[model samples]
Target: MSPQKWDENHPARILLLKEMNEGRIPLDSNEMGPAEVYYKYHSTVEFQVEGMEYNSTFTSRLRRLREQIRRDQGKPEKATKTKTARKKKDVSLTWNENHPARILLYKEIAEGRIPLDEKEMGPAEVWCTYHDTLEFQMDGVEFNDNFATRLSSLRAIVKRDQGRAANDRKALEKAMKNHPVQELNHRGEPQWNGSLAQALLQQDMAEGKHETMRPSELWEARPEYKEAFSRKDDFRWKIRQEIRTKKYLYTLEYRAEEKLRKNLKKEGIVLPDQDEDLDGVMDLEEMEDT
Candidate 1:
């Protein structure tokens, strides 16, 4: 009947009345109650709104908001399901035997892809220890000579777990591949024919010279020879020989010797017979005669 001012609360009602005057309202609502009028006007307001794109966009946004709420509530359930699936996968792939590669193989078996015999898996503790050992050796901060041996052992264990013949020979070969072949003489003693021998000979010659010369005369006449003679024991033929030979000896023996020395000193025992009588120890004449 009259134009209305734009009131935010009654915009929809105002729009409904305008549409009705324009003959666009879906139904005649003059007979409706106040509450019924509001409902009917609201429905007509929505219907009269132009553009399908705007309506579709609003519907889509509402749907997205509902999905976000559902996802938030379902997070724990989804996470639990995921964790269970991972655990099942791990169980299927684990190895059972006490092989060197048992830990790695067990992991593979847990995946269910590698079929392993139930009897083959050793004690769980042993498997765990072996796994830890391999991990330590492979990932240690400092590399050691024992790494090759440990790796070889791991490969052998893996082969055993798989029911395959252990390739120890190949493993050993591979392990030793990177190690330098120690240069040794005919008697398996390290070669000492370089500067070591020269240093020894020079000292011996200087010592022989010093035996016949006075200290003052020696110092004044040949200062260099005096200096060399002073270092005689430090560059002795016997000590050089020991160094060359000891290089090829078992490392455990050297460690044991050091430990013994340390323990002896700790117990206040002086190490007896520190020096060897070379002439008595090695009878060169007898060897020559023989």
Candidate 2:
């Protein structure tokens, strides 16, 4: 083919040039002479099947396929990070019935008033005063600064009265005759019994029969009476026992809700829709977890 035709894009001419350049075809003319060589080449062309003459054709096809694959497989986008919100902690105060200040404070709260701080006299004295108020025979009295102070003074008086009563009882018992008294029975001539001695002792045991006394009375009393009247330790032991027996377990559910509502109201916090039964709204499972 002409060079101009070869450059102009003829498929057959391109294939022939490519085969000759790849050394797949031999170019020797003297061995076979021109006529025989031409005939032999023609015969070989008719009988032999053709394949890719060079590795470049295979590599070029592979490069095109790889480019196609890269185009089809797109780049992945980056993921965005998320933030989790933290849960809020419960900040409510829990008051127990057994707490010395609880009853007094709760009483004031129930009466729509606030209690004064116990810092002035001391926590122990304040607690004693609160306890005295429980047994104090008064109506419509409210707990405040003045009330706490007065209650503390009253507790002292009650303690003193208890001591005096115990002292008076011992004196009366000692003065009673040691011998048994003679008494006639329904069907007997005479009977010897300690009924009089027992009666005197029982009379001394009666409550509210003795006048109030001070803390110093036991020591300040006559020397002979000191041994009989000294019962401060016994009284303290009894008081401790009574406290253990009388202490009540308090349920916090209703009280907690009421206090929470009151505190929220004071802080201007608006609550969402609520169940009428507050107990039902609280999660028992969560409470058990705590």
Candidate 3:
């Protein structure tokens, strides 16, 4: 029940305020709207798997998402749940529900405006289909630029995230190569210090030092991207080589000019426009080789 539904002078409201002051509870009475929370209870849906009882919103959402994907792929949707299929905690739920980009996408999905085969469609295609609608309409409210960009670049963003995950995994494997799991273990047995390893892995992922690149890092990756990165590197190398060659040729010419001036001085040959000082080698060097 909403706190607003109760009388302002109600004992529960007074108790809620007291609870807020105590700060023992996760919720703040002043922070929460009346309808936000009355009784601190969680709602869960029970789904049986392997004759074991489990209840979580994560399972329900994954079940729904898989079915949706299967339908999009022109395959029979898995309406029935598997007995052994269990849902781990949702890694995306916390981010997705609160994310501005996905929030806009979900709004479209909730409105039934998004096609069922959205999985098959790219973000550009989705944007083109609802470009005018999303760009202008927000229930007559002004369009938000942040939301607009997110809605437009939705698919690309998801693809990038997927690539990041793959890259992060690869990075973890490579890191573990040197610091073997057995080495990290105290007993030096086959047992691995998973907790420590996990922490390190999370730190590296957060730093994004090994995050995958698409067209830019292509040379180190796929054949298509290889050409682009290699081509750029080759161009840079050629430029550096040309600069080095010019520097070498210039150095050689300077030495040759020095030798020529020394020889001329030894021969006592005072070519035209003689300078009072003998140190004017630059002036002599400037003379044309006629």
Candidate 4:
């Protein structure tokens, strides 16, 4: 019901005021606040039938009355200017409902899908969890940034708002840094053994990491490969040995197709005619083994 519909002595006003006084309700009496609880009650069947506004105008009346009562009793101001200024700065840092990222994050927090207190969660872990969620759009808001960037910004702002400690932030940064690897064995490479180095090389090959050059030329130009192999003769022997294997040949083909597909995709080209053939040829199971 509208504030005009009720007297100060009305039971609705009395009960609402009681709830507010007991700290059982939010006095979200401002236009900017969500006032979720107020709206929940205002949307009751009786009030709905009366065509009450969901704009929270009723709470403004309660707010003014509460202030008047406090002033009459000679109560001091609850918030200091410094505190108010800090709050204003925090509000500016926070994303509003209009931000596409906020639309998803707010929904997730409200539904308990994601933790409301970001300070308790590690930033990287929270970021990982929000990756897929950030990809979704709510209420038709368009997101210009990619999912990773959006989640990164959202998480940082949340941590800032919660006053995440400097040491805790340093801990988060330490966790995000790449951990050092231990070379327990020295089969060939000083930094990495033959098995680990070969695995890394094969994975890179599968991902089309190298430019369009012969394996020998790549081995000569890339220092990592020289470190991994230790000798050009050994590299040559290994390539000749691996090329006989079915998995090796499949990996080469996969890298070639991946390179072509990526280049074509950048130009907005699709090979519709060969998509079925490509799908058939790109055996994921074999690629996984490679």
Q: Rank the candidates by TM-score, best first.
A: 4, 3, 2, 1
Candidate 3 Cα outliers beyond 4 Å, as residue runs: 1-101, 104-119, 122-149, 183-290
For residues 1-290, could you state the per-residue lDDT of candidate 1 as single tens digits? 34333243345434544544454532322222122223334344443443312222433433343344446545322323355334533442221232224344445554533334434543342334443322222112123344334334544555575553346666767877976455664545444445344454446444664446443443445444334334444334444344334333434344444454443332222233354333323233533433
Kindly report which residue stretches of model 4 are placed more than 4 angstroms away from their true locations once superposed: 1-4, 9-11, 26-37, 43-51, 72-74, 79-85, 88-90, 93-290
lDDT tens digits by residue: candidate 2, 77-144: 22332221011112222333422234455555334343233345554554445443322212223345
Worst 10 residues of 4 by lDDT: 133-142
Worst lDDT run of 10 residues, candidate 3, spans: 44-53
What's the lDDT of the predicted structure labeled candidate 1? Answer: 0.39
On lDDT, the candidate that comes out on top is: 4
Error of 2 at 118 (Å): 11
Model 4 per-residue lDDT at 274:
39
Cα RMSD for candidates in order: 32.9, 41.9, 32.8, 22.6
- Per-residue lDDT tens digits for candidate 4, residues 120-183, read 5544555456543312212222333443355556655656655666778777778767554555
Worst-scoring 10-residue span by lDDT in model 1: 133-142
* Per-candidate clashes, comma-separated: 17, 0, 2, 0
Which regions in candidate 2 have their CA more than 4 angstroms from the true location? 1-140, 177-290
TM-score per model over all chains: 0.15, 0.19, 0.22, 0.27
Residues 1-290 of candidate 3 have per-residue lDDT tens digits of 32233234544434444444465332311232221222131121111122211122322433443344446556674454344222211112222333333455655654556543446654556655553331122112123554445554654555566679899999999998966655323433222123442333334434553244322342343342232223546424433343344445555556554544443322222223323323322333433321
